[model samples]
Target chain A: MDFLTVIQLLDSTVRLATPLLLACLAGLFSERAGIFDIGLEGKMLAAAFFSAAVAALTGSVWIGLLAGIGASVALSLLHGLASITFRGNQLISGVAINFLAAGLTVLIAQDWFSQGGRTPSLMGGARFEPITLPFADALADVPVVGPVYAELISGHSVLVYLAFLTVPVTWWVLFRTRFGLRLRAVGENPAAVDTAGVSVIGLRYAAVVICGVLCGIAGAYLSTALQAGFVKDMSAGRGFIALAALIFAKWRPWHALYATLLFGLFGALETRQDVITAVIGIKVQGQVLGALPYVMTVIILAGFVGKAIPPRAGGEPYVKER
Target chain B: MDVVPKWAEVILVPLISLMLAAILSALVILAIGEDPVAAVNLMITGALGSTYGWGYTLYYATNFLFTGLAVSVAFHAGLFNIGGEGQAMLGGLGVALACLLVPWPHWTIALLAATVAAGLFGAAWAAIPAFLQARRGSHIVITTIMFNFIAAAVLNYVLVNLMRPAGSMDPATARFPEAVHLPTLHDILGVVGIEFSKSAPANVTFLIAILACVLVWLLLWRTWLGYEIRSYGKSESAAKYAGISPFAITMIAMLISGGLAGMMAINNVMGEAERLVLNAVEGAGFIGIAVALMGRNHPFGVFLAAILFGFLYQGGAELALWTSIPRELIVVIQALIILFTGALDNMVRMPLERLFLMIRRGNA
Candidate 1:
């Protein structure tokens, strides 16, 4: 392969990996705080659904993105109320919330929009326009890597930049900050954190909200940036993939980046199945390709790489006995 | 006002949680641009509108009933076996293959073979996670969910590409023979000149579901193996302390759960479809979570909870038809049931204990 093709392929892979990268970080934060946020799917779906709806309504992409984040944050609050405040089982509540989101989206979409859930496509606000880096055009004049630098490396959404920035930001926050210490402590021993008089509830709540915001962006990216207009069940188990990434990364932010990128590659393959098939002359159907990532996740999780030992108290809610 | 005693706590908490959930559902309806009261009324009327309505509800109900039992069996063994989707899918596929392959005149053999196929396939599907957990100490939830995806994909590919009947263009499998079909109990009811609607496929699947419930109860409470399984489910360490092999018990528990889930295919393919045809397995396996929870892992309770879900499903469909309300109210309702069942379990248990304590005090 030419150097140009390699750079171009690599560039496209980055744009594709952004959403998974963001969502995986969200999972990393929540799980590290010992909250197994299974409702990531619900949060993502709700955000995607709301963002698409609001964007289509107002014809403003920013408003839609904000709405998506708000919806996901609200879902996080619900998770906090049930699992944290009330000491409910995180997994069950998360799963329940996901089902509610799935059902509610379909119900509301049918009742309001009536297009079998493909909301009216927005011309402007419905999507994020790809951005070209300032120096990339000039850099593209370089031999071999020139076209690759301009097209693959440069043309991407703002979130693509944010996704890369988030890795170091997350690492610094989790390791450097006092709040990060508290969060990590809580994951290890909430009772001890409670003993130290740092409010476990407050820290966990903040972690959950942050997780929600990440999921919201992930959702918005899936709909507006990746493919415009909300598709029914559009998260398409990406949240679960994020969860798998978190496990694979051992709840570390930087490790999660690589894990998510791997998953993103799987997803890109799944989406580009026709291309893969055409190039290889393989006669695999669309559905088989679609199921590939899930298959990989299972094989990986089933002790192929290693056992997924979650945060010590992950999924166990803390209730103060006064 | 009287002080709420312990024994009544269990029942009261669930009652209150259910009411709260209902109110929340109403809010949800309002939020979705529908009249909650009218929508709910429609749900009731639609589910039980006529004998025909009752049939469809029962047919759907039987799916939950078997799925519920599948979940409940694992609950008894103290493992969250979430592979019901795959297990049930394989079950349906197994039944379809048997019905297609077994060319026989006898209705009994055809039905038996098909059901047996479902049970065995379900067992295999469940065994994947069970073996992983029992032998490798792998997490059941992840393995099962993965298995579900694989099962769904494989089943769809087979249905669309390989096993699908030649003449049908649709993504479905070969049609089952008429003889293997589950006979409707409504037909039997009509023998006494009792009238019911013709559209209803209210078949012997309901009875089969009920019988499975009874068998589960017997298997759990009556048999020593059931006792051992329950003990194992409660705690691996405790069960081991009591000399039970958690490995063997987990496998057995998972097999029964998967097997019963497979039996639920009777409702979907043979009982309802009149032949073994393919449609993607709906989220009934996941619904098994809510069913198992509402039933609180009890056989009779699971059976009753399934019927309740059936009621909600039928009513939700009806509401969708009558009003502008979407039919997913039932899905929300089921989700709420799961939420409430989990959240309010302690409250319910506490009230029951208090009630029992007060009753004891009064008796003394």
Candidate 2:
């Protein structure tokens, strides 16, 4: 492929990877703290709808972002209430959250906007605009690195950069901070952490809340930044993909970045299925191409790839006496 | 040790949870600028009022029964098989292939062949995930969820490119031969001198679902294999120690689950649509999860839950057709029911447990 084509593919990869990265990081926090949250999809959907609805109404992306976060956090707390406080099945609660979000988003959208379960398309300040980095124009005509620097690295929305920045921040917070130590400990051995005088439930709640915030940003990035408004089930299966990436990454932040980027590359390639088939001189159907990520994850999880071990206490609610 | 009576534990908790979910759903209706009482009245009248309504409700219930049984079977083996959606999709393909490829003399012969075909197809789809979970230690939940998406893509491709009749604009297969068509509920009821609606979709498959429930009850309670499966579910390590093969139980349970899920196609495809459509499975596979949960993983309970969900579905359709309440809200209502009965169950149970304990102590 030409350098320009390569740069474009890389650009597409970046755009596609942003939401996955944010959601992956969200999963990282929740799972690391011992709460297995499969409702990342639900939370993202809720955020996407609320963000788009608020953005279109108020014409301010910032306020829309906050509303998105609030909606996501509210659902996250509900998950916590069911799984943590009530000691219910985590997976079932997650599934319920997903259903609630799918239905609530459309129901509210239809009620408020009367637009067939879709928010009005945002314009101007209501949507995220791409920012051109300094020297991008000046270096546009330079040698091989110029296009790479200008097209591939520059001209992304603020959330794209923030998503990338989260990897290192997450690594530091999960490895270096006192809170991180307790969070990790709680996942691995909540009894030990509790014996060490830490409040296990409190730490888990914090992790879930952080997860909600990150998922909020991911959803906002989709509706406000990627598209102008929310559509029903628009988050689609990306939240599940993020969970797969979380497992594929072995529950680490740096690995999440790599895994999400890889998945993003798969998504980018999915859009170019015919091109790939033509270039490779092979017969590949779009449906088969679209199923690559899922197929690959199953293969990996089936021990074709390396082992993936989740936290020991994950999926189990903390019981003090037990 | 059992402060709450078994009847209350089995029946009252779920009933109360259902009431709670109903109250919350009514509030949501009120919030949407609709009269909750009217909506409730409409739903009852729409889902259960007449022979036609009952026909549609029972048709939907038939689909749920299959999927619900699928989930409950897996639940008994302690496997959370969420791939019912995918399994049912493949089953649709099985039904289509059976009806399209062969010239069966009658519906009975065709039904038998399709049932076997669908069962095998669904079981094959589930085998990989079950094997991975049992042998490779991969989590079945994630794998099954992924398979659901893959199943959709597969069904979409088949319907668009393979199944569609020549020059047809729609992405659906041609109608199945009339010989393969199952008898409708109206026909069977008429033979028995009972009046019924002619246009309702409920068919012989509803009877098949009831038969399945009885069979499942027998398999779970009266068989040694059922004992093995249940013991393994209760404690895998203990089962291992007792010489019950984990791999065998996992595979058997999942195969049965997938087969049950696949049988839903007999009702949806052969009975109602009479042709394979791209989204024939719709979201009934996911709805099965809620059904299994509300049913408490029992066959009879699943039957009751399926009927309840069927009511919600038909009533929701009526609301969508007549009122401004969108169909999507029904999903939210279903989710709330699942949340209360499945996940937030302890919120009600804990308080009731405490109350029962206090009563017992006072008596003591």
Candidate 3:
């Protein structure tokens, strides 16, 4: 492949990876604190709908972001109420949340827009405009490094840069903070954290809320930046893919970035069927490429490729001894 | 002794949960600027008002009966088999191959052969995940979910590249032979001097679903294997100490689950469509989850819950046809039912338990 084609593919990879990375980090926070959240896809879908709807209505992307976060956090609190407070099954709660979001988004969209369950195509300030980095234009005429910098990294929406930056921020907060230590401890062994005089429920809820916020941003990025508006089931199976990426990363933040980017590359390659056919000397089915991430995750999960051990307390509700 | 009475546990809990779901669904209708009462009225009349309506409702119920039982069987062994969608899809492929490859002399014989093919395909699809969970300690929930996507891809490839008829624009199999066409409800009822909707898709597969429900009840409550499965679900350590093999129970439970899910294709594919088509399962597999949850994973309860969902589905279609209400409202209701009955059961159960205790104290 030509250098420009490679650079273009990488650009799309960055764009596609942003949502998966954000959702992976979201799942990271919840799962790290001992709460398993399969509702990440649902939360992202809800956020995508509300963000697009609000942006189309009020013509303000900031307000739309807030609405998106509010919707996701509301669902997260519901998860907390069911799984944590009521001591219900976490996986069942996550399943319910996903169905709730999937149905509600289309229902509300249909009610409001009457255009077959989709928001209108966003315009002007309602959408996230791509931001060209400083010196991108000036360095365009330079050799290989210039195109790599300008074409591949320079022009992406503000959310893409923020998503990448959050990786380092997450690593710092997780490894370098007292709250992080307690959160990780709670996930591994809540009884120890409880013995240390920290409230396990409070820490877990905090983690869930943080998860909601990141997922909300991921949804917003999909609707406002990556695409022009909301579409039915727009989050698709990205949430599950994010979960797979989290497992592939072994629940670490840095590994999450690389894992999501690799999944994202698979997604990018899916769009360029000609490139794949040329390299392999045979036409590959698009569905095979589409199913790659899920198949890989299943392989990893079976421990054929690598073992992915979740947190010890993950998916279990905590109960204090009387 | 149980804290609550059996009658209340079976009847009152689901009743109260359904009411809560209905109230929330009503509010959602109000938010959409539609009349909740009117919508409910329309649903009732549309789904139950005529023979035609009952035909569609029963047809949908047949699909749910198979899938709901699929979920319930796995639930008994503490396994959540969410791969029903994938299993059902593969089952359609099985049905197609069975009907297309052979020229049967009779419909009954073709039905028997298709059922075996569909069940085998579904059980084979589920076995890998069950094996992983049983031997490798993989989470069945995640593995099954992954299998759903893979199954969808497999179906797409088979239909497009392998199964599609020559020169056909659609990614669907050619029509099945006349001998393989299962008798619909209209024909069956006609033999009994009863009139039914001629165009409706309700068929002999519905009877098969009812029979399967009975068989499942017999398997779960009457058999020693059922006892072992239930014991394993209640407590793995206790069951292990009691000499029940966890691996055997898990595999058996998932195989039954996958087989039942696959049988749904006999209704939608063989009885109704009479040919294999892409996206035939739609979201019925997920709807099965809601039905099983509402049914309390009991065969009888699954029967009742499946009918209720069938009513909602047919009625929702009517609403979409006549009114501005979207067909997806049924999905919204289904989600609420899952939320209230499965995830948030304690929200109603705790208060009911308190009430029951108060009544007992008064009696004392």
The candidate that achieves the highest TM-score relative to the unseen native structure: 3
TM-scores for all candidates? 0.92, 0.98, 0.99
For model 2, residues A1-322, the per-residue Cα lDDT tens digits are 5668778888999999999999999999999999999999999999999999999999999999999999999999999999999989999999999999999999999999999999999999999999999999999999998999899999999999999999999999999999999999999999999998889999999999999999999999999999989988999899999998998898999999999999898888777765576578886777876677788788878878788889999999999994
lDDT of 1 by residue, B1-364 (tens): 3355534444566566677678889898888777887876777777787787788788778898888889889988878777888899999988778777777687667767777888999998898789888876666876787788778778878878898678888778666766676668678678888787776777877887888889999999999999999888788899999999988998999999999888778778877775544453588888888888877788887877788788887887778677766666778887787787875455445565677678878999
Better by TM-score, candidate 2 or 1: 2
DockQ of each: 0.59, 0.86, 0.83
lDDT of 3 by residue, A1-322 (tens): 7778889889889999999999999999999999999999999999999999999999998888889989999999999999888888888889899999998999999999999999999998899999999999999989998998898989999889999999999998888999999999999999999999999999999999999999999999999999999999999899999998998888999999999999998899889888877777899888998899889888888898878999999998999995
Candidate structures ordered by DockQ, highest first: 2, 3, 1
Residue-wise C-alpha lDDT for candidate 1, range A54-110, written one tens digit per residue: 888888888999999999999888888778876877777888889888888787777
Q: Pick the candidate with the highest DockQ.
A: 2
Please list the residue runs of candidate 2 whose C-alpha ends up more than 4 Å from where it truly belongs after superposition. none
Per-residue lDDT of model 2, residues B115-217, tens digit only: 8888888888889899999999998999999999899889888888888999999999999999998999899999999999999999999999999999999
Docking level for model 3: high
Docking class of 2: high
